[model samples]
Target: MTANPTRLGAIRTIEASEAPAAFFDVTEKTGAIFGENVFSLSVMQKRLPKSVFRSVYATIQRGEKLDPAVADIVASAMKDWAMERGVTHYAHVFYPLTGLTAEKHDSFMEPVGDGTAVWEFSGKTLVQGEPDASSFPNGGIRATFEARGYTGWDVQSPAYILENPNGNTLCIPTIFVSMTGEALDHKTPLLRSEAAMSEQAQRVLALFGHEDIDKVVSYCGPEQEYFLVDSAFVNSRPDLLNAGRSLFGAKPPKGQEFDDHYFGAIPERVLGFMHDTERALFRLGVPAKTRHNEVAPGQFEIAPVFERANLASDHQQLLMSTFRSIAKQHGFECLFHEKPFAGVNGSGKHVNFSFGNGNQGNFLSPGDNPHDNAQFLVFCAAIIRAVHLYGGLLRLSIASAGNDHRLGANEAPPAIISIFLGDQLQDVFEQIAGGGATSSKQKGVLSVGVDTLPDLTKDAGDRNRTSPMAFTGNRFEFRAAGSNQTVAASMVIINTIMAEALDFLATEIETSVKGGTEFNAAVQAVLAKVVEQHGAVVFNGNGYSEEWHVEAEKRGLKNLRTTVDALPEYQSPEARKLFTTYGVFSEAELESRFEIGLEQYVMTINVEANLTGEIAKTTILPAAVRYQTELATNVSALKAAGVDADTADLLRVSEMIAALRAGIGALDDAKATGHDHEGLAEAAYYRDSVLPAMLQIREAADEIETFIADDLWPLPTYQEMLFIR
Candidate 1:
């Protein structure tokens, strides 16, 4: 019998595919539609009374607590604005530990003793809602019988309307927590960490003679990389649907070796998808700025302008959801898995991070001459000390089973957490370490040989794409974050660590000033001390090189290469003290996160191992056996007809079929061991035993795919899925 026609039919469907109807022209309506769906400050000002507006504005812009007395007025205004835009229901949207957006919706209609319903959104309803706690992964924060969780309104993040063809819902970004007011979502810790960072940052600012500063915020501009596959192909691939990646497909003949796909022209269909996605994002007030092809075929990237970390986290979730929704409209499936395909460049979200208030601008900006700027040097030194002291936590923040496939694979940053200060900044820091820095490197002008072109300004140093954290002029880009992960976790760790570093430096400077040292002298002394003690984490060399790994080990940097290894860093004494000191996370919350990380890792591998075995046994093996029978039958016919037949194809296919069956048995055996262990031991077993068994099965299946006839192949080939679109 022949194999299923799904793969070939999918190819035909793609060839006959037509572009969806055009969304509104973005260039013409960018300004008009931007933030139109969002119930922003401008909307509140128009709807609320003068006093009410002032109270709400103070909470949003100044990070002040919202006055409870004004809650009713604000809720009424918000409901009226949303209902005007066709919103019949409202949802309190929260980010749970699952790293996905969770929301519970309630209709605005209420009965007033009549058949008809009236719209009612009171202050009490707007401030909080209850969602089942046990249903969500809480790292054992709640038991099965205890199902109470609260969603509290987050005044800092703005509310927006999400559109649907059937109806629209007003979404209020909130924080999820247990009944005792412990954080159970990503947003709560993120917000708490921001407050911690701001408090310490303000203390440092006072030493620079600044007073009464506004609240400081960490800003993030995350560059999201993903691949677009035709929906038909995605539907046919079981591994892609279940595991979010290809478990057995062989590499295509043409990969990203030519490097021609980088920044290449976008496909017309994908461009239409982008237009629709950007249009939706604009209405939600997400400032998506750049779009282009990535280093691999079918891979693309979108970058947004920096926003406050809390808002950026919310917008990042919305951005991903929007992409997924809009891609379906254009007949594509957007994949955010870190490595969706084998032997290709994986996706990563490079989070560009910096912190400052509106009055002070970016604290990390070195300006024209960094050596002469004492304030910038202090902030820079703070980052160095923070990253050096807590490199393991930094690594653990981005660790996940999905990211493990990408990290240390040469395309992404290696597992050793290190900072890359470009040549200019490296020179200035070196000078500070030796004594007082006297000079800074300046940018040079570039001249094209062709006289017709204008002279270009060149940066002081070349960028290292391999660096995990690189200081690009203004901000440090965290290149290790997975494309599918929430940026909040990374921000939480960064904020908490920086708070400790800043507090340390600020106290030292204050103590020295009290000891009769000059203000400028005190600043320089603290900066020098930081550089001497914590400068080992700074590296200007290639992070992908083997030599750098050796060098890092020599410098005493811990290389946590897997999720099992990295997740335990959360329970380290230093991590506990840092989070508890800053009040970002209680010990219970910290322990909960560690358990959740291990649980998620173990579950991820278990699912993948099950899928690999099922697909190999049910799909790959059958296809291989069928092809082997055909080859054997052909040889029999040729010999019967008195003609010599080549037996090479038959022999190879038979060997692969045997290997596939044996590999499946081993995978099943490895998976059975998982029941015998629990927690870290279980995760370690999946990593060491189950993962290797799955790969063995994949090797046999992929090898068989090369020999099996195309029509007999059950799954979609990588060549078809990757390049057909």
Candidate 2:
């Protein structure tokens, strides 16, 4: 049962062991070691011919096809750089539909005629790789008999070196698709969505005299929030070890109630981990920009600077994987579950998105007068129309069993998708909606109460965390993404939906102009039509309130509350039309995604349900019965001795013990009825029947923990786990 000793290298494995050594010696002798392992622009420039380098750069920046001739040069450069860094193997790293990264490593060694080997990597090997599709979750895209899957290099994302004690491998970011040309991974569809957005956005930009721009990319900066618990405590807690979250922990008496954890000083151990993570990220070309304590105890957030959506999503996956590895070194376990702790704030990945071209021109940028900026108004209206038309798709994009526990809770956005424009932009949107002409407002410089204070320029509006989607200056922060989700799914939906909306706007504007309307009038007409039709999506109020839910219902917004409710919308006719029209996903591909999502939901809940039953039967039930027996015996002995024990306490303890047994019996009954994983029925069964039983069992177990003696409690308490750092 021991792990293979060969897998353990020079780095000592922790065993009945203390925390890892304080510092890792990442050398500075190669001061340029920061990106020395990556096949980056700097490496390319040094290794490639000037013409070849320019061609590759053009392909990456402009989204043009890579020249076949230049592929060999790029491969040579990548191979040489990787070999120099002690890499003996290479992998086509991809994000599969499983919502995690997948890779197949192959050694670069080639055999010569006589007992000798030479390292070799060719353009064919670097550009494309074939891995079996049967083993991966393909959602029926590829049959079991047809096992071919292709990994095409995404040159836009640079290749990096992944080092482990076992070996060093070069990882090329790639897109995965089936042999039949259907997308089998998250990245392929994301790239298609990006392409669709770029084409339409460029057309929109051309109307504003930005003809020099070849493409416009949607950028994302996802703020990832997570919690860290001591590994010892985590391992001891069966629920957390199996579920990635505690299923039966009583809420700590002190849990984020005083707003003390928010922005509090970081613990030294956590800070050390953060520092190490950031350093690793920086060396890998990830622009990690912000780090801070979050509202919940043991929770924190790390945000990166904005990059093109494709690269941003790729980096997010890498960051999460790296975080897990680094946390282990720091004697911590990183929990990305949307709701890891009860009665406290949960984690969310806040996605900050914007549209821009190569010239650094943001389409959503409001000039001196946002109201009068016709181009900005048009782009903003496009977003409004897209969100309104496809709110269901947006909801489905973020739907998952884990996130179901977070959304509509105080910590995260409500299930309803509504826009928050703040006071200033709300006024502008309303003015346009009312068909009133708007004039530019004069810029005001703020003067301090004293002359010693410097004059300051102010932003137009304040932030609203209540909004599911909020326009924060230049970007819209989509706050519904769960911390554990791959950013690709959400970004793909946003990009494709916006692309369709922009295309609609462009066609309408062009038709108006052809029909003798003036250019300005046509633009205004498009904006007005968009505001009239989709303005219902805009709400600048508290979404967490009951009033907002009723208001949303009145406005006809669909509130799909859970994964079971939201996921079916993905295969709706409307979704099929939208995705297929933009070429983001074929009908088959969409159906496949729906199947995969549903299966994943069922699988997640089933695992949690099984884990709950195991912990309850093996740990909780036994502990509770033993404690109850001891209490009963003590009470009986005291009564026989004519000494009055606290009868009330004994009766209360007996009552809870009875209730716990009932809950255990109910859980057993639920488990006996096995789940049907064939269709939506399975999802509904898990959500309604199985989940309620799980919750009931947890409630009883948690109550017992609160009353039981510390020595009798078989699991780590929330107080110990949450405050142990």
Highest TM-score: which candidate?
Answer: 1
Clash count of each predicted structure: 0, 0
Please report the candidate that would top lDDT against the real structure: 1
lDDT of 1 by residue, 136-183 (tens): 887877887899999999988999999998999999999999998889
For each candidate, give its TM-score against the true structure: 0.99, 0.95
Model 1 stretches astray by more than 4 angstroms:
1-4, 25-28
RMSD of 1: 1.4
TM-score, predicted candidate 1 vs. hidden true structure: 0.99
RMSD of each: 1.4, 4.3
lDDT, model 2, position 470: 98
